[model samples]
Target: MENNSKKIIHKGISASSGKFYGKCLKILSGEHLILQIHISEDEVHHEIEKFENTIYLTKQELESTIQKFSKELKKELVEILSSQILMLEDPIFLQNVKERIQKKLENAPLAVHNTIEEIAERLSSLGDGYLSERAVDIRDIGERIEANLVGKRSDYTFLENLKEEVILVAHVLTPSQIIHLDKNKVKAIATDTGGKTGHMAILAKNYNIPAVVGLIDITEKISEDEYIFIDADEGIIIQNPSLNEIKLFGASSKTDFGDSKFKPKKIAETRDGTRILVKANLESESDCDLALKYGADGIGLYRSESLFLEHPSNNPTEDEQFHAYKKIVEGMKNKPVIIRTFDLGADKFENEKEENPFLGKRGIRYCLQNKNWFKKQLRAILRASVYGELSLMLPMVTSIQEIIETKELLKESKDLLKSANVPYKRVKIGIMVETPAVAISPDVFTKECDFFSIGTNDLLQYTVAVDRNNSVISDLYNPYHISFFRLLVNTIQIAKKQNIPVGICGEIASDTNFTILLIGLGLREFSVSLPLVPKVKKIIQVIEISQAKKLAKEIMKLSEEEKYLEIESYLFNKHLLNNLV
Candidate 1:
């Protein structure tokens, strides 16, 4: 294609939104071609020298520009560019590619591109999108190397003076690229490649942009400056849209999607006066904003696993852990945040070894065995609570004694914090009702712990003796089982009898049907994903608690074989109102 005839309309996940018109700077596929090396040993040595020189130049150029941005951006840019450069200099990869090219007697650029393409295709076929994207990065590196091998330099350019009212399209997007997008200027984003979990998908969600992904070869169909319409609801992209479609989508798109400024009302009373507590699950400090925006009554479950995942190691220092906790609490101010301690069991931790990890070392069991690691997490929670309303919970507690011992450990850590002159709030402690042992013995656990949070996900798995992670038996692990709901209600019933609060911070809480069931079952507090709160809250507002309770009673009496489909149809047919954000 001639440069004059080249048109620019790359499809991508719209990280930011708007509509505008600009001239094209089409980035063709062959620009950064990496050649395969098939020369003699002396030539191979010389090629390595060239690769080193190119890497050094790229590093120096990046370093000189580092100070122009904030620390996070600088760090990310360095990490991304550095990784690409390092891959080029990897002796193993370089040697392997060189040998393959020599054996094939092919053009170096063609050979390298083919190998990268082949590997990418294989990974893509494996069915994991995350793993497939890694292949794209490899191909990108090869392109950069190919450019160098042919005496070409990287001509990557940033889009400047972007139109303020333009819809951006691309094949895909990255977290780093999304961060740089001017959200105020862009209208919507559409991509040819991505899924709901991809970084671009998450960013588009947070930015309140209309985004559609996984459309094949859409870049070729879209024309530069052509009026287009994006409907995120149906995952539809209409190029040169008809006037009727534009009017409909434009009206829907105008609704406010950003985080609400006010904290979510804890008193989630419907117009008819049914009350429910809308709590939020915390994954990290970053999740706090989403929680507050959604008007969460409090933080229900804080997964400490994300902190460890962010760092390069399995364990973070107590102080570092405290800082992460403190950030979330400080964000909430006086609102309560329930922090769950290190949940790393043999299965969750990459470095750890355990036989039948789920049944082996997980939750409270793992904490007890790794006393020092457990204490550090407890100490961090204690220190952070000094700043705001805070509470702690132990996950995967199977026995009454485990809860008792964990409570004792909490006391020990609290005493240490007190001795150090840290002013702290009196924290309410709880245990996750996960295994059937605790569910059946709720009377014992309720008496020992301050509160309970039914971890429905794991409880369902344990109830059916099915591994939730195993796809083969996924159908068997049903949360809707009459017995499962019975256990949950029984546990909540125990908490109510004991006058100790029981909250649900599981995926089930987010489902509208289950929300009603829980309310009817005498469970008053619910902690759900931030995005689902409005809909759940709205449902609570309209639902009659007595009706739900009556339905729960009916469900409890039905046999397992008769309940699943009956309940599904009943709920689906009810036209149960849901507030989707």
Candidate 2:
């Protein structure tokens, strides 16, 4: 890793935390050239068999990976990789490729690649016509199966067999690509393409690796085995650093509570003795223990749709939903748990197509349209409510009419349970304040819902009119934009005026400096990815409310042009921990 060159720095989006020094390990990606080959009628049957067998092999690999890394990976990531196995077993998917090989006399690789390309294109047609989350999954799965058919080493296996500890760089890396990585040897990651909300970023955070993406041309810039320093905390990279710079950085990394979750975990409180609610956004019951381990104040978002999605048919029975909800509620032992009802749409679930799935029927709108399915989930949640403090949260709610209708359904659910002589409890209801309609008229919503959780993921997208997944314009989807902050302040103030509780449940990873900014804006609760509980707590424990308020006021006063100039200085400053206040 030793080098003799001028020091250079590059900036990118910070996808994970902690800094490290290692030799560069560049992973080059190239298109897998599948030459189309025609064959005789007799060879067509053989091609179909080969295609089926290759899928079986790929399925076995995915299963083994699931069993092997189940502990290290978080529940959501495990689900993502598990989705690949489902793809391999899909009867229609298998039939489609077999049809191509048999009818067109195509080779197994060519048939498989063509079917995948078609499906990927079809998936991209959903929700703004970009590469949706599911499209990426399909494409990654295709790469795996195609590689298996051609007798090539899979991406994870090649990367897993590395001989030395190093920083990995690639044109791009999918969550599927990093499934079998050797965490011990792969010290950090740098990539040429990715965004904060992409699956890779979520996985990188779960695995606790230092990662920076969206460098655009970093793969071409960095050479193999070169010494480089990754300041992932600030999304900065330094190449061929002097020994003096290395020593200074190395010393700080060691003492930064470098190992383990923060020991002596207790209630999170700020410097001025104000308590902060650090909640975990739970999607699966398996993560309940992990949340408790990290001293989570409560469950901020129990995405009940995950349970529905987990079912092979994408519809779990009432008992199935009840048990899962009950388990998470009981595990928390009386701590508040907020469960969001099914948030599925055409883009996410198997259903009739829409011109714009994200803007069309989704969340409460979908549930309302299908009342029977909606009531079943409501009854299950009502049943689980008695086990502990559980709340029902409606997602994508833009109007008070949705709340009124949902209440009527809740009453029907209770009546059904009452007729059956089943026991249940009435729980507080909440709404995810993500839509611009709600933000535009915040006061109207405060009187209806018990509380609000600002879902910044969708809010930022709906308000900014840019999809964060689209790399071409994702740069413009800024949380620090003056318009975004104005809307945020408006929502927070309206909720405060009505004496309603409010907090944020998304967009923490996009900007590390925004934690205090949120608190300064009067947000008291933080329901984040479970892995970030300790990091959030550390920030909350250091700063006082007064200082955060002052910073918020100053930032709000800046013009759009002046705001970026001033915020960039604070954003790029690497030593904020020591001088946070």
lDDT at residue 86 of model 2 (Cα atoms) = 87
Per-residue lDDT of 1-581 in model 1, one digit per residue for the tens? Answer: 11222222333332222222222222223345343445654455455455456555555554444444334343334455556656756777666655655565444565566766776788788876666656655655666556655767544334224555666666655543454566665656666676544455555656555566777676667766655656453355654433322332222322221344533355688555756788887654755665776688878887787677545465689989989899999988689889887777787667788778888888788899877788888888877877888988889888877877877887888788789987666777888888898898788877778889988878888888898545344457666676787798789877888898898876576555566667878888988756566657766765676667666665666635565656664444344323210
- Residue ranges of candidate 2 with Cα displaced over 4 Å: 1-264, 509-511, 574-581
Question: lDDT of model 1 at residue 226?
Answer: 57
True-structure lDDT of candidate 1:
0.65
lDDT of 2: 0.79
Question: Each model's TM-score?
Answer: 0.60, 0.62
Q: After superposition, how far is residue 190 of candidate 1 from its true place, in Å?
A: 14
**TM-score, model 1 to reference:** 0.60
Give the range where candidate 1 is weakest over 10 consecutive residues by summed lDDT: 19-28
lDDT values, one for every candidate: 0.65, 0.79
Task: Please name the candidate that would achieve the greatest lDDT relative to the true structure.
Answer: 2
